[model samples]
Every structure is written in structure tokens, then in C-alpha cells.
Target: MMRRWARAAVVAVALIAVSCGGSETTETTASITDPPQINRWVTVGGIEVPIGTTDGPRGGEWEPFAGFSHTPQGAALAAITQSVQLSTASDRNWPTILAGVAAPGEGRDLYAAHRGLVEISGTDPEMVPTIVGYTIADYSDTAATVDVVQRFSDDSLASSTTEVVWTDSDWRLHLPSDDTATITALDAVPSELVNLEETRK
Candidate 1:
């Protein structure tokens, strides 16, 4: 469960950073327009994540995760891209992924330090969790919360709530100061969830 382990490792920063300190943010929703297309899927550390053709990753020449649009679709795409990167990051690329996707501050440092302490493995490509759908739970010009639904090899479903903030012309994953970001097991995908797989089909 490399994907699940990575997810836990990153989310566990709440407790790990208690002694170090973190950052906080508020959620606000305006109107959302222009749903981004799942132009393709890319495999990172054996985990698959969608890439958008229109909304972002507009700049991947320097860093694969460097360029993203500042729109709602960009934020959502960024949240999904960053989530998969965080969940699948290994020693080989964790630092690069963290640097490109994570917002700068105590939180990112804490996450990096915590991941550094652990030796991660078990990235069985067949068993890894696959992102199935997503919902933009909340959105504003500055911040957005995206609920990403992932289905593991066992066929069970879970949703990770990722919050990203606009920073320096791009959207970066924002680990909540209080460790409030969460992954919840789901009985079934919520009706409101947008199925990116369906869109791709």
C-alpha cells in the first residue's frame, strides 16, 4: 500500500509537527466554471493521476509539478496532482515533489522532515490506489478544497480532502495547520462527485 502509506505519512504531519508549528487557512466558495478535462493520465512511482490539458501543468519544463493555472480548475487539478505525488513519493523524488507542489512554510518543512525519517516501500503498481473521481468541495480565488475519491485494489473507496492555496502565481497544496485535512473511507462514491474516469471515456 505505498499509496496509502504515503497518504498517511503526509497527513500524519499534524501530530509530528505539533512541536514544530504549522499554518492555518479558511474555506470560501464562489462560483466554479470551466471544468478541466482529463486529457491524459501519468504514472508516478507506479501510481496514476490525471493531467489536464487546458487548466494547468502549463509549465512542467523545469519541474513536473511546477506550473498550474490560477483558476478553480487549476486548483482542483493541482490538488489532485499534488495529492498523488504526495501519496506516491519515494526517496528518489520526494524532495523534488515536495519542493514543487507544497506551499512554503513550517508545514512543508515538517512534512519533509517527517517523510525523511521513514523508509518507504511497497509501491506495487497493481495494488496501488487509483484516483476515480473528485469534487471541488469549496473554492475561492485564493483557496480551494478538493475531495479526491480513490479506489484501492481491494475495490474499497476512500476520499482525501486536499486544500490548496494560491501562491506565487500557482496553486500549492496547503497542509492545514491543525492537521484537519482528512481521508475518509466511503461506503460509495457520493452523487456529487465528478467522475474523471467517465469524462475520459
Candidate 2:
């Protein structure tokens, strides 16, 4: 996954985030799913997440197929970009990654992995990872999917995808169900959790 490799880099937040090798693409592409009007910004984990559909918003905007899947893909890109792409390896980043994951000990495991990545990469002031590109591989009304490609300073490129769920109020990383975390490109694969989530949506 993009984040798996990102956590091992020199603190993703320091990344310069450039489009892989292709010309940088913006959100102006007309889509059948485009809304009548655009929202200025949306709240995610209390942070004002920008919309990439105009003026080529920078920062946490995960340069991907925005507005294509609306809430699902948009939220996935934001969280992935913020949590993994430009991560500072700070505890503050954990809450957003853990917002909707109610698994008893999942946060600790993810945090530990995150810390390990930072430690492995150490700190490099000159380090900057390039974001090649991302695609919303597939999606459904309740599910959003995406694939992000990035290149670290070492010249190694990695790609990963994640699923996001619209919890009515916010979009969260769609985690593996309690029974089984097995997931596929088009589906979440059933888990032990009856409702997919341990708690109500």
C-alpha cells in the first residue's frame, strides 16, 4: 500500500508530492457525476479538507479522480494523502486514520507500524516523495476505492489502494470486517462483524 511504504520514508509530511512523471492533472475533467455546484470545503476529522475540483487545491488534496465518486473517493484520497502520503508520523495523524475504525486494538497496531516506519526512515530535511498519480479503480454507492502511485527519493515507486465508507457525517477508511479482513477490488468481503462495522453506522 502507498501508506505502508510512506510510513517507512523520511516522514511523509516533508514530501514535495509531485505527479509521478506525467503532466499534472487537475480536477477540471468533466464527469457524469459532477454536482450542480461545488462545495468550498468539507470537514474531515475536524480539519478543513479542500476540494480538488477547482484552482487545483494543494496540500492534503490527494491528487486523484476527485468528484468521480464524490464522498467515497474524495474522503479516501484526503485521508490517504494526509495519513500516508504526507504523514508527519505524529500522533495527531492517528486520530484521522482511526476515526471510524472501532476495532479494539487496531489503532495501537497501526500506530506502532507508523512509528516503526518513521524510525526506519529517520529524518531527512532534503527528502521529498513524488506522488505519481491515483485512480478510482472501482466504486459503489456505499464504497469508494482508489489506487495511489508514489515515488520515494530512492527512485522506488509503490502503489496501493484503500476503501472508504460514508458514515453520513464523515468518510473513514473501510477496514477489514471483524470476522475476516479479506477484501477484493470490487467488494469488502464479509467479516466476523455482522454489520461490517462493530457499531452502528
Candidate 3:
């Protein structure tokens, strides 16, 4: 079930996200701060993802998906929010979500073409995965790499790494040139993961 959703939903548009290798350099300009506590969770496509009322997304023109703070926590939050939005986007909302959250790039253009096709002919995906937690892989003022941990109904876990850049005044999703930078099945959720669901409870 999770596999089917991945192929139809996430994989179809998930290609826009940047790769794991290049562009994740950690900056030494300042110390990394702890992410704000999960004060709430907003359900998207039946999945509940974290939200920190005090720290950020701070809100924007895109409402839930835009205007994150410039802090590492803000970047992390933006990554998680956009990852879920991209994974769950359907024909009705993909374009708006893409425009609102993604940085302008060739990768995003290619993804829009592919996603438009899916919207035209593909069936709406079922079994969208739920985000259980996340980890910040790297961070800097200009760019960040966030690994989002998702949990299937069958209890399997995987990490979906996304890159967000500080574009204009807010964090925007940075799509890479390739589609191979998405999810990786995990033996277990990492110990370092800031378990959102667990913490909120």
C-alpha cells in the first residue's frame, strides 16, 4: 500500500527535491540551536505533521507552507511542511502548492510537467504515509537539508531528505536536477530524531 502511494503520489513529483550529496555544507557562522517543541500538528491528506506555534512557520502568503523563520528550526519546519505538501498534492492543489513552496528552477519546471500529466490522467493516490518525526541533516543561513521520517500503516519507516533555501525572506523548497533523492527505508527511526508525534502527546 505504501509502495503504491509512493509510486503514484510522492515519486511523481518528489523528483524536484535536491540530492543528498552536494550543497549540504554546515556553516560555522553560528551555533546550531535546538528546534522548537512541537506545539501542534496540522493534518494534511490524513497525515499529521508538526507545527511550532512560537518558533515558525510564522505564516506567509502561502499560509501553512510559507514564511518560515531564518533559524535552523525554521528551515527544518519548512522542509517538513513542504515535503508533506508535495507528497500529498493532488490535481486540485499541486500547482498552488508547487508555486507557493518551490523555488523557481529547471527541476521544478520538469516536475510541474510530470505532475500536470498525472493530474490529467492518473488516479488519485491512496495510502499517503504519515510523518512520525524528523532530523536536521545539515544547516546554514542560505541552505538546509532536512530528513523527514515517515511511518506507514504497516509500521515501516523511511527517511525523506529535502533541501530548503532561504529565498526572498522565506524558506523555499529547492528541487534538484534528478528524481533519485527521495525516500530511503529505515531499519528503525533514528535515535536523534525529534519525534514529533511522541512529543506532542
Per-residue error for 60 in candidate 1, Å, reads: 6.3
lDDT of each: 0.65, 0.36, 0.65
TM-score of each: 0.77, 0.43, 0.77
| Candidate 1: segments with Cα more than 4 A from true spot | 1-34, 58-62, 178-181
Estimate the TM-score for candidate 2: 0.43
lDDT of 2 by residue, 75-159 (tens): 4344344434223333444343333221224533444454445433333433444444445555554556554444555555544
Report how far off residue 154 is in candidate 1 (Å): 1.7
Off by over 4 Å in 2: 1-76, 85-89, 100-128, 176-201
Candidate 3 local Cα displacement, residue 57, angstroms: 2.2
Rank all candidate structures by their lDDT, best first, as comma-separated numbers: 1, 3, 2
Q: Tell me which of candidates 2 and 3 scores higher on TM-score.
A: 3
Q: What count of clashes does model 1 give? A: 0
Model 3 scores a C-alpha lDDT of 0.65
Which clashing pairs does model 3 show?
16-175
* lDDT for position 191 in model 2: 26
Worst 10 residues of 1 by lDDT: 14-23
The digit string of per-residue lDDT tens for model 1 on 1-201 reads: 556645543432221131101112232232354456767787665666677876666433224474666667778778777766665666677787777777888777777766788876746554566777778888877788887777766566777778888876678888655534576767799888777776654
Evaluate model 1: give its TM-score: 0.77
